[model samples]
Target: MDDLFRGKHHVKVDGKGRVSVPPGFRRALEAADPNCGPERNATVYIAHWDGEPFLTCMTVRGMQEMTEQVRAMHPGDPDREALEEFLYENVEELRLDDTHRITMPKHLRDAAGLEGEMIFGGRGDRFRIYSPDVPKPAVSRLAQQMSTRPAGTSPFALLPDRPRPPAPGPRPGE
Candidate 1:
């Protein structure tokens, strides 16, 4: 999964709840998933972030990679059932148009309290679209949590394990 999706763009949440994904952002997305078929079923999992309800998109492969790791760690054991349920409940699969637009579901919009202005933020393997006004407490809390967390604890730890590359051979001419 690509880990460098950082950009900013204006988005307008239309009356029908569709947002115009910026062309530049779309290009970045296309570059990330070159093998995605022509009729892209860009499976995305959006969530509210940075004080607003923002949409996040990712390829299905990315999401699956994430989930597999979680399964490895927890395995849906009774002790981890809640975590498993939370993961299942939050992630969503959506289709993106050839135009690179995604229609926000009403429940998601309503949960985020999105109305007019929107912000699309590319965050590596995923992107988040946020409402104009995000709750200050939420923002501060996330900042504090992120700041306090240990460096090794990634959100993707629950995903399937990736094979570590082999060590480099002896230096050339050695």
Candidate 2:
């Protein structure tokens, strides 16, 4: 299985609102966008939903997938409109610079209460940026719950199985 983004990084936000993306996370972003290169910087969509204490950053691919899922809903559905307003209307597409840094928009920074220090945490196809002052009790709870899982049992074992390739036979010479 493809290993999506995974890690936690602490970065400093300069007075200009610029923050450097962690090297590993930068690589993950690049990998998520095949078209990204030295000449073309990868773009991330930031969304600060109502009542959320952090900003969610998603790769272009993730954003496209979310958009597609949203489009699949009925055009006149209230839920669809609310989702669009919350996700699409509130999102800001920011392009990484050559130094793998981006200037967090004023609105987002203010909404997330980001100051000198911020936390960037990877979450598979997306990531979240939180203020240093955010609480860690939820993280602790999740770790506690995960530790209770029975040994040799995968958390995903209950999920439907995906198709796998057939085993290859030995060569004729062998």
Candidate 3:
């Protein structure tokens, strides 16, 4: 399997709004950015959509892939327009520094109501930066769901254990 982003990290947001990314997450981000190496900083795209309570972080390559998908949708489609706005206007590109930290812009911090300690939840291909308070109604729903998951049930049990098939080849034109 690929180097998936997993686990949760509680990170401190500094006075200047910089947050050091967890080492594991940094590795995945670097690997996903094709041009990143010792000489180049890894790039990240953070989406601060008002519909969500957290900032969604994506690797440079991952954002590119998502952009392509959005571009393929019909121009007049409302869903496409919404997705495009979310992908473009609401997204901020931040490059990781030598210490693998990115400075969260003031606007983004204000949008997510982030300060002090932030929660970094790895979500496979991407990760999320959430305020400690997690004020969204979705968080309440998630907590309720967790409360109802039968006692002694393992979360991993929900995932299929079978090995994944290899990824498909590139499109014919490309």
Among all candidates shown, the one with the greatest lDDT: 3
Better of 1 and 2 by TM-score: 2
Q: Provide TM-scores for the models.
A: 0.64, 0.78, 0.81
Candidate 1, run of 10 with poorest lDDT? 135-144
Evaluated with TM-score, which candidate comes out highest?
A: 3
Candidate 1 Cα lDDT to native: 0.64
lDDT of 3: 0.85
lDDT of 1 by residue, 123-173 (tens): 666666666586544423345555676887775554679999867998766
> Can you tell me which runs of candidate 1 are displaced by over 4 Å?
1-3, 31-35, 48-57, 74-79, 135-137, 140-174
Let me know the TM-score candidate 3 reaches against the reference structure. Answer: 0.81
lDDT of 3 by residue, 63-164 (tens): 999989999999999999999887889889999999889999989988888888898888889888888797645544445555678887766655668988
Q: Tell me the tens digit of each residue's lDDT in model 2 across 1-174.
A: 232667888899999999998877777777777678868998888988867788888887888888999999999999999989978689998989988899998888999899999999878888889987877643233455556777766656556789998679986778
The global C-alpha lDDT for each of the candidates, from Candidate 1 onward, is: 0.64, 0.82, 0.85
How do all the candidates rank in terms of TM-score, highest first? 3, 2, 1
